[model samples]
Target: MDKRNQSTVTEFLLLGFGDLHNFKILVFTLFMTVHIMALTSNVLVIVLVGVTQSLHSPMYFFLSQLSLCEIVFTSNIVPTMLWLILVGHGKVSVAQCLYQFYFLGAPVIAQCLLLAAMSFDRHVAICRPLHYVTIMTFTNQLQMVTSCWFVGFTLTFFIYIFLRKLRFCDLNTINHFFCDVAPLLRLSCSSTTSVELTTAMVSFLVILSPFIFIVATYISIIHTILKIPSTSGRHKAFSTCSSHLIIVCTYYGTLSSIYIVPPRDNSINMNKGLSVLYTLVTPLFNPLIYCLRNQDIRNAVYKYIQSFRRRKVVL
Candidate 1:
């Protein structure tokens, strides 16, 4: 089949985390637990936020969207991984591989914009309290979310389209656990100029743009936090933002290290290991960070669990 006209790739073989002498099964079980915990925790946060009227604020709204993205992100990668690990088969067609790439990457890019937007929301809420409602209005927030989705999927779709034009006659075996750009590019037989350039452009725009904005917002936030007169007041405000900051830093730092930094070639396993943190670990933490650190969510979860037990006892 001609490269430009090619529509099918017979099959793809994913070389997962790596060959463990006898520990691959353990790794599989570990990820299975993560999937369950991630799903349950994020769902609970969504439930708590949706049902509780008090939780209907810009911060929580951003959290809600973050939870949604984390859920979609985890769902995209984990089920396929589980199927592969359990069945000892990670074979995928070109279509399936591309689909997985789109589904996974779009949310990830969207999430970057979403987090930057959330930082802005926090900045306004904390630093410009009087105008918070006016600045972060329902319409404005919706527009932001929509913009994130647009930017995210647009990059993902373009990358896929560009890659589709190239021929992969050299190597068919994927080195990483997931369909990452660099690893996949290693397999191409045609000129990688377009793919590499496009990927670099997209990555620079997506990662760097949001990162700069987020850092600016946080700098302003810290300045404002320092200006507070009362220690208690500062503590309370910092407490609210601290968990979000932790989650944000963990996500972005590891992701930047993985994609932006040049792969050492020898430490490809380190790259895959870091990928697991973003893909598997973040989903598990998103809900816990929001709920455990948030009183409204904690209260709602407590009530929901109690009510369920009561109903069960009555039955």
Candidate 2:
């Protein structure tokens, strides 16, 4: 790979499930259905939170932000993958690839922070019920959500800045579904030691730290719940935080598997499968898990439906 040959590279091929080309139609249909379901469910949560005044608490506020992040996060990558599947063309320009990875990484980090925010809200509510309102005021919630978005963008910007300087040379084919940092780094002909180290530290800050905080919060929550004298009281306490726990576990479980575990030669397919689970399947199920488990959300949805029905009858 000489300098002359390296200078000609301007595009990269995304080898998205190339082995599954025989099942392209099936894969396209499956991903399309998942994308629609994810969008509808997340948007429904947002709309419900906005209209249902009773649901306007610090927890629901963070939940709505999480939904918004999921919508943007999935939108950044899924559509392009679906289109490429349909067209059988995986070519993406250097600029397009970089932007895609940048946007996707931002939302991914935002979601991690949003989840941490949600856990902190739960901790305040469960551990310090008397001061929960004072601690988690509307202004504080707004600032926390805004900070998450800001940090998300800032961290990813540095990542993309380093990535942009890497020389791709002639090895421009990305062996994954999207322009993820790992795949892109793999394709870079230049040394990625600094970029890799930076990414690792960012991952710890964005993903690992939040995850640890959430765990600590839940541990305190559990300790608090155990002190309650009555069985029904403990049940009631657990019920409220259960949905958040489910979502947190589902998200971090798959995500940790990807980042924590070392990649290997034989596990590329396995890694892609895990990516699909986290990126595609997790977002689709998040709203459903929350809505189904939450009685308040269910009641709000029911009331909304009844109001719509009454209007239809009047018209």
Taking every candidate in turn, the Cα RMSD to the unseen true structure, in Å, is: 2.7, 1.4
Per residue, candidate 1 scores C-alpha lDDT tens digits across 2-63 of 65664434667887754565776897899999889998888777777788888887788778
**Where is model 2 poorest over a 10-residue stretch in terms of lDDT?**
1-10
Which parts of model 2 have CA positions greater than 4 angstroms off?
1-7, 19-22
> For model 1, what is the C-alpha lDDT against the true structure?
0.82
Write one digit per residue (lDDT tens) for candidate 2, span 1-315: 566655657999887777556788898999999989999999999999998899999889999999999988888888887877777658999899999988998988999999999989988888899999799999999999999999999999999999998878767877778888888888788899889998999999999999999999999999999999999999999999999999999999898888878888888889879988877899988999888999999999999899999999999
Leading candidate by TM-score = 2
Candidate 2 TM-score versus the reference:
0.96
Q: C-alpha displacement of 108 in model 1, angstroms?
A: 0.4
**lDDT score of residue 78 within candidate 2:** 89
The C-alpha local distance difference test score for the whole of candidate 2 amounts to 0.89
Regions of model 1 farther than 4 Å from truth = 1-9, 87-89
Task: Give the Å error, residue 191, model 1.
Answer: 1.3
Best by lDDT: 2
